[model samples]
Target chain A: MQEIPRQTEFVEVRGRKVQWTRGGSGPDLIYLHSAGGETEWTSFHNRLAQHFTLHIPAHPGFALSTGLETIRDIQDMAWHYVDLFEQMGWCEVPVVGFSLGGWIALEMAILRPHLIARALLVAPAGVRVPEWPYAELFIDNLDALRRLLFYDPEHPAIPQALPTSLDDPRMLNWLRAREATARVGWNPYLHNPKLPDHLDRIRCPIRILWGREDRLIPPAYAQWLAERLPAAEAVQFESCGHMLPFEQEEAFCQQVTQFCR
Target chain B: MQFFAFHLMPWDRLPDDFEQRYETAWTWIPNSLYEPGHGGTLYNRYLDELVLADRLGFDGVCVNEHHQSAYGLMPSPNLMAAILARQTQNVKIAVVGNALPLYNPPTRVAEEYAMIDTISGGRLIAGLVVGGGPEYYSFTMNPTWARSMFREALDLILRAWTEPGPFEHYGEHWKLKYVNPWPRPIQQPHPPVWIPGAGSKETIEFVAQRRFAYMGIPYFHIDFFKKNFDAFREACERNGYTASPSQLGWLVPIYVAETDEQAWAEYEPHLWYFTRKLLKGLVVLPPGYTSARSAATIHRALGKFLSSAQTRQDIEEGAYAIVGSPQTVRDRLTELAKWLGVGNLLGLFQLATLPADLTRKNMTLFAREVMPQVRASLAESGL
Candidate 1:
C-alpha cells in the first residue's frame, strides 16, 4: 500500500505558533503524540490517515511549535489544545492519543468534556501506580528510554526512532519535545496528582489500551484508569511494551477503527 | 587583589572504583554511601579550613550549594556562611552563593542573608544562582521554569531586602500579598550581589548589565575562562560601562608545596577524584536548564570533565587545576589574574580527598607566601 501525503501547516493560537500536519479524507480525528512528539508520519499515523482525516499538532514546544514558554503545566497544555481546537472550530472530534499525548487527551476529556467525542488512550500516563512506577522518560539514559519504550530489542526502527547521538541535529528537536514534556510534567513526574480524583469528568466513551509487557507505565494503570474514567474499557496487548501503537500497530488501529466506527 | 578560601566539603570517601561503578555522583547516588559519623567530622574540618583562612589574612571565605552529591556537602551555604560570619573576623563571608530557584518563598534567603549580614557587621557577599542542572533533577523541579523562577525569585529577594515592607509581589512563579523580609541586610541597599556562572553569554550579559560580581565557576580550560572573561568585559562595554575589577572573580583550585614535583604528586590523585568521580553527571544537563545556545557554550567547557583530563599534564594543559611550588603558583596566578582582568580570587584549597593538614598548610602557604607576592606583582605591574 502507498503512503498518504501529509501537509504541514501552522496557525497562531494564544500567541503561540502551533504546527501540525494534516492528511486523508474522512471525519476529523486528532492524533496526539507521545513524549517523543512522534513527528514522523509513521505506520500508525499512515494507517489511521487512510480511515480518518488526521490532524497531528506538534503540541507546542515540540518540533517547529512555538510559545512553549506560555504553557505552564499539563493543565496549561490541555487549555492550549482546547484553545487551538476552539479556534479551529474542531468539536466532538475523536482523538488517538499515545502515552504523554494520551495523558493530555485524558485531561482534555476531563477538563472540557464536550470537546472530545471519544478517545483511544494507548498506554496513557495520568496516575501513579506506586508498586509499578513509570520508568523514567526524562533522563540522561537514552538507552534505557529506548528499552523502556520498545519490547523488542532488535526493532529495526529503534535506532532511527530514538537517535542517541548528541551531535545529531535531530537531538535539538528531540530536546525541544522532551523539554515541553518536562515543562508540563516534571514536578509530579508524569501524572497530575489531582487527575484521578476528577476522572469522573471524563464523560467521553474511551478505550484505555496498554501493553501487558509495558515497562514505562505498567499494564495495571489501564485497569486503574478504566476503573476511574466514566464509560471507559481497558484492553491489553500481548508481547508489547510502552510502544503499544508501534509494536502492535495493526491490531491497535483495528481496535481504533472498530471503536470509532 | 582580593582572596577568598572556598570549600566544596566533598565526601572524600567515594570508593576508588566510583568511576567504574556509579553512573553519577549526584541524585540516585545510594544514600548508604553517606556515613553520618564521618560526615560530622568532615563538616567541622571543612569549616575549620575556612575559619583558618579568616584567621589568616584572606579577604573572604566562600561557600556554595549543591545537593545529593559528593561534589559539595553544603546544601545550605547560608549555614556555612553563618558559621564563618560568627566565628571569623575581618573576612567577608561569601555564600557564593545560594541556589535561588530551589528555595520556596525565596524571602527566606533574603532574611537569612540579612540576619548573617547584620550579625557579621555587614560581612556578606550575596551570591544568587539559578543553580546547576543536577539540582533541578535532585529537586524534581521543572527546568523549563528554572530561569523564570530564578529571575522572579531574584527580583523578589532583592525587593525583600531593598524595598520597604508589606509590598506585594505578583510574579508568574511566585505571588505574595506581603512581599517583605525583616532584618534587611546591614549593607545598605542589601549586600553586594555576586553571581557565579560558566561561560553562558546570557549569564555574562545578565551579570555585566547589573555590574554584579561574576565569578567564573572553575574546572575548564584557561582559554575558556579567558574567552568568558573577555566576553564579560565586552558585555560590560555593551552595557556602556567598563566593569570594575571588583565585578569579576575567578574560582580556581590552587595548591602549593615545597617543590613543583611534590605539589603535582600531592594534588594529582585528589584532582583526578574531584574531576572524574565527583563530576560524573555535570555535562548531562536536564533539558530547559538553559537556552540551547548557552547550553552548547556551557557544555563545551564542562565537557572537559569527561575529556582526557586525567593526568597532571592534561590537567595543567587545560589549566583545570593550578598546583606547583610557591614561586610557580605565585607567578602563574598573578599572570592569569592580570590577564583575565579579574581582581577577586576564590581558591578551593580543600579539593576532593585533600586531607585537613595539607589543606591547612596549603592555605597558610597561600596566604603567607603567594598572596603577598601576587598582590604586589599585580599592584606593581600596574594592572
Candidate 2:
C-alpha cells in the first residue's frame, strides 16, 4: 500500500486565519474526513499529495482548530470548504474524501461545482439504498455491523475495537464536533433521502470506490449513484470495509490520482 | 429451547385530531396489495404496534421491508429497531435486516446493526435476509446483485466482529482498503444471526450450513413448514451433521380466545386484512428482485395458495390465522411441533388490525396455556 506524506501548517485564506497543510504542490487535492474527523483520511491525502498538491485542513473543530461552537452538520462543513477554496484562491481542484468526508465532497459539488474540478468519494454517505438503512446500522450490533460493512474479516483494514469511552478532553471535543454534525446530518437512519435526486445537480465528474466488505455503508449505495449521478462512475474494492482509505490506501490513492488526472 | 416471537402489533384507529405535521414528510407503502388509504391511521397503527411489541414479552419482534405498499408498515426495519430499543427492554429486537442487494455501501447495514446492538444491551438478533420482491420495486436494485450482496454483507459483518481493527477487505462487488469499525459490538464475538425464508431449497440449504435458526414464514398452513423443515434436515444430513431441533422454527398466525368459535370469528377480520389488503398489495415485485431459486419458491407457494382459491372457508381454516380456544390451539400447535420437530415456535400474533383485547387474549393464552404444554410435551417425548 502507498502512504501519503503528512505535514502540519497554517495559511491565511481570505482575511481569516485558517489552518491547512499543503504538500507536493501541483493541481491541489483537498482532503476531508467524515464526522469522526480527519485522522482516517490522512493516508489517502498523503498518497494524493505525491501527485497533486494535497491540501487538507482540519475541518472546523477538527485537528487543532476550535473557532466554531460546533461543526453544525455536513452541509456547514461543505460551506466551510467552499470558503476555504475562495480564501486559498484555488480556481478549481479535485476533492477527495473517505466516509463522512465523502459525503461532504458530494455536498460541496452540489454547492459549487466550479470550486471542485472533480470528486472521488470513498464509501460516501448521504444516499439511502431502499433495502438498507445506513444511519440505522450505527445502532446495530458489532457483528451485524461487521458483516454489513466489510467484505472480509480477514482483510487487514477492519478494526476490532472501537473507542468505548470518549472521556478525555480532546476526545470530548471530538465528540462535540461529531454530535453537531450528526444533529444536522442524522435522521431516518438512511442517508440523505433526497441525495439521489440531487446527484444530477452536481456537474463535476464523480467517482465512488467502495470496499466490497465495507461494513459501514453497503457498496450498493454506490451503485445507486452510478445509476442516478448523471456523471458518476463507481468501483468496488475487494476485501475492504468503511475504512478503505487506510486499509487499501495504495490502491485508494492510485484510483483517486487516476480519476483526478 | 430458547424463545422467539414475531410481532407486528395491531393498531385499530389513528386519532383524527392530531396535527398532520408528519404526513407530507413521511410516506408509507401500505401492506395491502392495492393502495388503500394513502398514509392514514393504518400506517400510524403499524408504527405503534412495533413500538409496543418491544414492551411486550415477545423474545424477538419482526419487521420487514416493502416498497410503495403499506402491507408491512416498516419499509426501514432498522429505523423501527432504533425506536424500539429506546422504548423497550430485555426483548431481543430483530430487523430481519436490509435486503442486501437493495442496500448501498452495505456498511450502513453494518453500522446500524452495530449501533442497535450497542443500544439494546446486546439483545439483538441479526436477521440477515434476502428481502422479498416488493423491495426491488422501491429501490430498483437488481435482484441478482441482492443475493450476492447479501452473502457479501454477511461475510463482511462476521469479519468485522471477529477480526481485529483497521483491516482491509476487498471484493468484486464491494471493496475497502480498511475494514476497521469504531464503537465495536458490546457482544464478545457477535450477536446471534437469524434468517427468514419462504422455504427455498437454496435458503434452507444455506441456513442449515451455518446451523442458524431457519424461520419458516409460509403465511399459510403448518404443513408447508413441514416440507421446509424436512428439506433443512435433509441438507444437514447431507452435510454430515445431525440437525438439531432448536435450529428450526415456524411462524404461525395466532389468535386465542375463551372459545374456539369466538377466536375464529374475531380472527377473521385480521385475516381479511392480510389477504385482502396486505398480500394483495405484494403482487407486483420489481425486476431482478428475486433469485431464480427464490422466484421458483415463491411461485410454488403462491401457486399452492392460489390453487386453493380465496374463499371464506380457506380463510376460516387458518389459511392466515390459527384461531381456536386454549386446548384447541394447543392441540394444533402440538401436532405442528411433533411434525416439524422445532424447538422454537414463532407465534406471529399480530395479523394486520386485530383489536387490542383479542390480541392480548391471544398472547396471554399462549403464554399461560400453550407454552407450558408445548414445553412439557417436548420434554416428555425426549426426541
Candidate 3:
C-alpha cells in the first residue's frame, strides 16, 4: 500500500484560525493530540491515516491555532472543535484523543452526542478520581516531567532536547502549548467536576486505552471511565507509561485501527 | 531617602540539615517542622521589631503575604497591617501586599485595605501582587490566569476606592453585581500603590503606565536591578512621564554590626539559610506563573545565579545582601541608591534564623548607625 501525503490547512471559526492536517481517503476521523501539543505526522498518525481520512487539529493556543485569549476552559475548547467540525461539514465523525485531547474529545461527545460517531480516548484526563489523581504536570521540572510521561525515562521515542537548535520555531510553539494547557487545565487541575455525571449524555461508542505503568494518571482512571460511560470498552498496554501512543506506537495504532473498524 | 523596614518572619527552627533533608523550605516542607508555640513567639518578636522600626523613625514598616511556607508566616498580611495600624504611630504600615488573585471576590482586599487605610489615618501603601508561583500551587490558583485575575482585581479595587461605585464589574474572571465598598480609604485618590516585580518588561511597562511605585525584588544581581530601574525609567519616559526617584524602590536584605568581620560572622549562617534552604527550584515560578517572554527573560538574567555553588561571598559581592560595618553598609547603599536612582529602600532587617535579640540589634544599628550615614552620603552626593 502506498503512503498518503499529508496536507496542512486552516479553518477559521469565530475570527480565529485553526490549523489542521488532513490525509488518507475515507470517512473523516479527527485526531486530538495530548497536552504536549501535536507533533509532525508520526508513524502512528500515518498508520491511523491509512484507515480513515485524518483531520488532526492543533488545539487553540497550540501551534498555528489562534484565539488563546478566548479559550477559558475545557468546555470552550470542546465548543471550538465542534465549531470547526461544523465548518468542515463533518457529521458523526469518529474522534481519537490523547491525554488533554482525550478530555476535550469526551467533553465534545457530552456536549453534542450526535456530532461524534465514536471516541477512542488514550490515557484521557478529565474524570476526577480522587484516589488516582493525575500528577502535577505544572509543578514538575523537565526531568521529572519526562520521567512521568514514559515507562522508560530513556525511551528513544521521547525527544531528548526539546528543540534541536535555539532558532527552532517548534520551541516557541511548545511553550505556547504548555502555557495554553496551564490556562485551561490549571484551576480544576486537569479534571472536570461534572464530567463523570454527564458521561451518560455521550451516546456514541467509547474505547478507553491506558498504559499499565502510567504514573501521570493510573490505569484505574481508565476503568473508572469505562464504568461510567454507557457504551464503553477499556484496554491496557504493558510496559508503557502515560505517552501510550509514543511508547507503544505499533500496538497503540493497531488498537485504534481495530476500534475505528 | 525613605527607608522601610521589612520583615519576612521566617520560622527559623528548621532542622540543622534542612538543606539536605528537604527539597524546599516552602509549600511542601513538612508541617511538623512548624510548632505553634514557636510560631507565636516568632510572630510577636517580628511584630515587636516592626513596632521598634516605627519608633525609630522609619518611614514604613512592611509585611508581605506568603502561603504554606516558612518563607513568611503571614498568609494574611492585612491582619498584621491592622495590628500595626493600631499599635504603631508615625509609620506607613504597608501590606506589601495582598495577592489579588488568591481571594475569590477580590473586593475583600479593597475592604480590608480601606479599613487599614482608615485606621492608620491614610498611611497604607496598598501593594498589590499576583502571588508567587508556589502560592498558585498551594492555593490551586491557575498560574496562567494570574495576570488577568490580578489586573481585573486591581481595576475593580481602584474603582471601588476612587469611583464612588455601586456599579457592576463584568470581567472574564470576576463578575460582581454591586461593587460598593464600605469605609472608603482616607488617602485621596486611594492609597499609594506599590508593585514588586523581578525584571519583566510587561510589569515594568504596566507599573510605569499606572505610575505605581515599582519595588524590585533582590533575587538577581545588582546589575539586574540597575537594568530593571533603567527599563522602568525608559518605560516611564515612553509613557510621557518622568519617573521620580521615589517611584523606584529596592527590597534587599541588610545586616549590620559594629565591625565588617562581626557582621559577616553573624549574618552568613542566616543568609545561607535564606538563599540555600528557603529559595529552591521552579517552586518560585511554576509553569505559566509568568508569560513565556518574562520566563525567558528570568531564565537569561537569573539562571546562572541559581546554581547551588553560589557562596556567601559571591552573594555579598553581587549586592544581593548588604552586610558589613555601619560605614561599609552606608557606602554600599549610597552607591546603590545613586546608581539605581531609587529614593526608597526596603531593608529586610530580620532574616532566616536570626534570633530576636540579634534582629533587634541589627535593626537598631541600621537605623542609628547606618541610616544617618547613608542620608549624609546621599546629601553630600547632592542626589
lDDT per residue as tens, model 2, B246-344: 777676677778898888778776676555544543543222234333544464566555224366567445444567888887787777677778877
Question: Between which residue pairs do clashes occur in model 1?
Answer: none
lDDT of each: 0.85, 0.65, 0.85
RMSD, one per candidate, in order: 2.0, 19.2, 2.2
DockQ class, candidate 2 = incorrect
Indicate the residue-level lDDT of B219 in model 3.
65
TM-score of 1: 0.95
**Candidate scoring better on DockQ of 1 and 3:** 1
How many pairs collide in each candidate, listed in order? 0, 108, 0
2 or 3, which is superior by lDDT? 3
Q: Write the per-residue lDDT of candidate 1 for residues B20-51, one digit (tens) a residue.
A: 99989887799899999999999999988988
In model 3, state the lDDT of residue B153: 96
